[model samples]
Target chain A: MPVTAVLHTETRVVRRLTTDFPALIAPDETAVDVTGLDINLSGGFTVLELDNSLRPASPEEALESGVDEAAAGARRKTRHRAASVALGAAAADPLSHTSLREALTKLRLAMYGE
Target chain B: MGLSVKTGSFVTETATGSKAYTGLGFQPKVLLLWSVGGVTAGTFRTGAYTSVGFGTDSTHRAALGWSSQNGQNFSNCARTQGPNVLDLVQWDVTTHIRADLVSMDSDGFTLNYTTVNATAKIVHYLAIGGSDITSCTVLDWPCGVATGNKVVTGVGFQPDAVMHLSIGEPSSGSSLQADARLSFGMMEAGGGQWSNVIYSVDNSGTSDSQRHQQTGKCIQKLTTTPSVNMAAQFVSMDSDGFTVNFTSVTGVAERVFSLCLKGGSHSLGSFSAITSGGPAQDSPSLGLAPLTYLLSSFNSSGQASPIGSTRWSLGGSDGTSEETAWANDTDALGTSASDTLSKTDKAIVICSATPAVLGEADHSALGSDVFTLTWSTVPVTAHELLYWAIGAGAAPAARIPRWLPVMRTHDPRPLDAVA
Candidate 1:
């Protein structure tokens, strides 16, 4: 008898974040100009207005204190919380016969960081 | 491991005439070692050979001589069978022989039965020989072979099937090589068969046959330069727009730009007809009376002043105003000598005489001649005009006026007198 062997495996990762934030508008505002808002996720996460007048606040504080009153002053300001999430899966030796259940189990473990 | 022949018993036999009676019975078991040569041989012997005698009877004598030697005389001889014993003659013999014996030849005189046995081993060797056959056939060729044991006479007897055969090496050092070539040729004489020829014509390379050439009179090219200056030079004789030919500083020769005076009070009624290399003819001549009051500007936006070359300002109304000073530059005929024109200034011409009424006869009409000419004492006007007589022998005459009262007065006369 002759024998042949093949191997297959897969890896997956998923990261998720969710938060609430506050938005502000002037009392006599017609349309909100959000073009100046910059959301940077390159180094951790940070959100800022292109204009110098606004100030930043924590995600918790932004949700606790609403945006309407905080933006009422002359130099209006608001706090917004942003989340960056991703999910990905990769496989090796995919052509080989292997237990799909086992590959999926490994992928799930990798995604959950368990 | 060694062979030892022992005599168990012996007896004497006497034959008296044909009736030799000898009751001799002794077990004679001979261990035979047979050697045979050649290709066809058996691996083992089937039956047993023994030597014994019970009586001198013919049937018993044959059996007793089973151990007798027929031709060669030897001091020690292996057991042999007589020619008359046909049953034992057909036994197979093999090459290479060895034997171990615990029995001996004996003659008995009423002996009880005793058993003797011997062990022998025979070995056989075999060799095989073979030769190879060679065959080949072209691909896709129709071929057949006989289906049954009967000889096939015609093509109909052969059945269709793929013939698969193998080729073997003819000799140990020989090598086989096969070569083949495939070629194709096509000829197209006088448009050969369309089916056999491949055609890839690109009709897109040719111009579309459906396109039609535009039919109309040649249009003249109009060269125009927009201006903001109210006092721009112009050639007045060109009823059409005037063409200004200027040599570019960059060595471009004879670049022409046209300038036309728009008419009406607002100078707003501008007509842009196509112009050619030479003077362009006026097409559908527009009425210039309505554009009199229009402030003419050199630029399309009309934001700058046409006079003094600056910001927008009201064009003066009076004929002597600076804005209207463009009129002072007019020629003797009251047409602008240069291309410039004042804002409020305009050219005016007055006719010296009124045209005569038809069908009213009087002293001025002259008598009822076939062709008559009437003369006006008024001075010759300063304009070109043509007159026609609606009678026999009458022809029109062109009148060029230079002054109002220079010509002599004369009474009505006949057409011949005027001629």
Candidate 2:
């Protein structure tokens, strides 16, 4: 990450959430604003934008729209088979350790407020 | 082979020294020290490295957090000064380099300056090593002191070695102190050269005659380090970021400091003698990533005593290893958290506290600072404007995204009010 710590995402908010997704993270006096989130996202309406290229080898337009049948070639030939099916579905996740200890106990109860 | 960079400078008189091969050739794994001040007083250990070790086992070593004098100037940086320590400035200091002193048989490596009243003067060295550098990062902090034709946007990866130091303001009105230091590297000769060291405080032999300015070659890809015949001005070198116009020959109110090194793509990574910082042999840009840099401390033209240090000591001591998967996911850009930039250059992170161990270590996994993530809007050369990366759960999904959503950062404990 010495690639100058990688954050080159200059002003490009192309939103499209549908219901409510906020809580991406907050502080600096609780700063959230996913268009002031109301709440929604089982994976229905999701189109947010901030791009610079995720480079974990997706994107030939996310392999022509979310890995469509490995999208018939191109993009350095499906980037080594989408980095081997996204690292074999994250090493065949078996609920990866109780979803990582319940996301570190909801991140230690939202970072120790209790 | 891959990353090898070399350059030399010596001036201590009463304390210590070393350098000059007559023909040098190759072998050195890493070394970067810059004093410019006078090395005010005590501190700066390890000299005879057959493996290459000088500073960074976690601060207090690189001669009191890398001094130009304590902040009279550091690469041209003082930034209000006080012990920010820039996360002990590392990635280049896998805990204070000393693998055996990284190739001492031939290509340079051995610097010792402890104390004798500390005021001999002149210290500017950059000696890298190569077995095939594999991966590297060295930016040496201090990013402001501008005016005239300013550009500087290096350090975003893709360098084969680049260095620049424009220090002025140690004496107020700035008349002339030799050439007033303006160095550039990435040379095998003929192609890259632009010199002017701390020849006491700046002296191109007396007055910037022609130290070495082949065409004043810069660097790029922006980071690669290794050196045989680099002979650079590389232009794009690889271009993840590059732009350094610089115009401080007394451009006005003068104060500048730039050091960029990304050594080795190798076609040539050794050779020196066009002048300036001359006689280099090349090597040092080891195992890629971790130069988040920002540490400083200076003192000496008068006395208060503060010395030198250059870290990013670059990897080795794995819990998992690719250097710890590039130091665990270096998120650099994930986007959103008011827009980003508040990760405040503390720079060093190592195993990333934990995300099940993050990336497993290759080098670099720092991010989460830069404020509202705004950057006013890109292109000042754009190395992510100055820092980025914000994806872990809620969004920002990509642009360098990886993950880091623990209420955005740390938890000394006091959050949880948002329901």
Candidate 3:
């Protein structure tokens, strides 16, 4: 039982899309949560670190990390949606664990941890 | 996918758009590099690695650089000026770095840049690391002739946060015209600590406000100067990494960006000084546990009452901008608010708790100045914001440090650092 991961933070006012003229704005959002991590944190977190994991892939993982090209699939114009909408309704609110996956699982447990 | 992030892309030729572009596996504490230019300049580098590979018994690094090149905009070290010089906000060039993360393979580390290029620049770097990052010092330098106040010292340890950036100034025009600036700063290392200077441009480029205005130039100060002396080229901070005092150093040569963050590095949890009579107020409750946040309405929103992210605007109030970024949020704003509010604009949100978070699980019911517009009708401004919280508790530290020459090499492949 040497597994520890308890980090939680959730502040919301959500909605943002500024340019003015009713472009939409709520601003004042914050998120992070991990209660015990086995899986399912809730939705609302996005905390990356750990060399961002070597960054460079998100056009569907850059075409499965092969990166065919088209400006590298344009670096993600589509894909990245099952849900996870930048916190709007807190991503969908599964109890809100801070979404973006789980901030990608916290960047892969910060580069492969537990 | 827990935290150690990584993303790469580079294309700036004309003979090495400066230099030092590593694999970014460890030698990074927190480096973000983006590009989209107009009235541009050159010079770049941002690092954090305490013992990665470089003379002095082989490893120690912390970096930041900026070069506008033209009679050299006078002050630098990724910028640190307390006097004047800033007001160009054109478009794209958002860079933010936080350092400390050593052990690079077998003595490997370098993120170089010395100036050269006003064209072919296509960069998109993002390297994040873990293990609560212990150390990294990137104090790069380049000031050809005239000198006076510019200091960067032995950052052996002792650093919670400090950032500054400057390249070579002179180029506040070209394009749809907004406010072209390439100077940046943000801080947190101790008391009197408050530093911000940004102008991320996105003036009605309208791709969702260019995805978040990305412009406005920044300014923030509450300096005590730990060892700083940078006439503010762009950004500034403390905890050993420049004790600058170059009242005037010409011949165009100023490029500095110093980053140092020990453990977590991101202090000051909550602060909401937004009193004016808005029909929407609530910000008097952040004691911690509420992650993510960084704002600047400094001396109230500009443009005759323009602070309406959620409220504090009655000049022509337009609520509900409908959005909530954090699919991995990273922001750099300051396009207009009368130009980043003069001094007082900074946001470094990454949370879990701290800032004096009380109990009941440390409450984060999220109630900051919850306004909608109505502060005595309109005009008592300074649309405030200053929240700095990071991570939450401390987790990431499983891999990265893979370069065994053997010296305490535990080998199960989890934690075995040595540069």
Q: Which candidate has the highest TM-score of all?
A: 2
How many pairs in model 3 have backbone atoms within 3 A of each other, for residues 3 or more apart or on separate chains, i.e. clashes? 147
Q: What DockQ does each candidate score versus the true complex, computed on alpha carbons? A: 0.01, 0.01, 0.01
State each candidate's clash count.
Answer: 28, 123, 147
Count steric clashes of candidate 2.
Answer: 123
- Model 2 agreement with the true structure over B1-419: per-residue lDDT tens digits: 34344444344435433223322256544444443222321122211010111321122111212111111110111111111111111111111111111124464544332222233433433444555443344333332222112333444555544443332222321112211122223321112232211111110011111112222333210100001011113333345434443221111222322333333322111111011211111111211232122111010111111111111111121111111001111111111000001011112111121211111111122224211111111112101001111111211212221111112222222122212
RMSD of 2: 26.4
* Docking quality level of the chain pair in candidate 2: incorrect
- Give the candidates in order of lDDT, highest first: 3, 2, 1
Angstrom error at residue B83, model 3: 20
Greater DockQ among 1 and 3 belongs to 3
Instruction: Report the poorest 10 consecutive residues by lDDT, candidate 3 chain B.
Output: B339-348
Model 2 regions lying over 4 Å from their true place: A1-114, B1-26, B34-127, B131-163, B169-242, B245-260, B264-408, B411-419
**Chain A (alone) TM-scores for all candidate structures:** 0.19, 0.19, 0.17
Residue-by-residue lDDT tens digits, candidate 3, A8-99: 11211111111122221122222222113232111222222232211222344323322122332233323222122333344345776666
Each model's lDDT comes to: 0.16, 0.23, 0.27
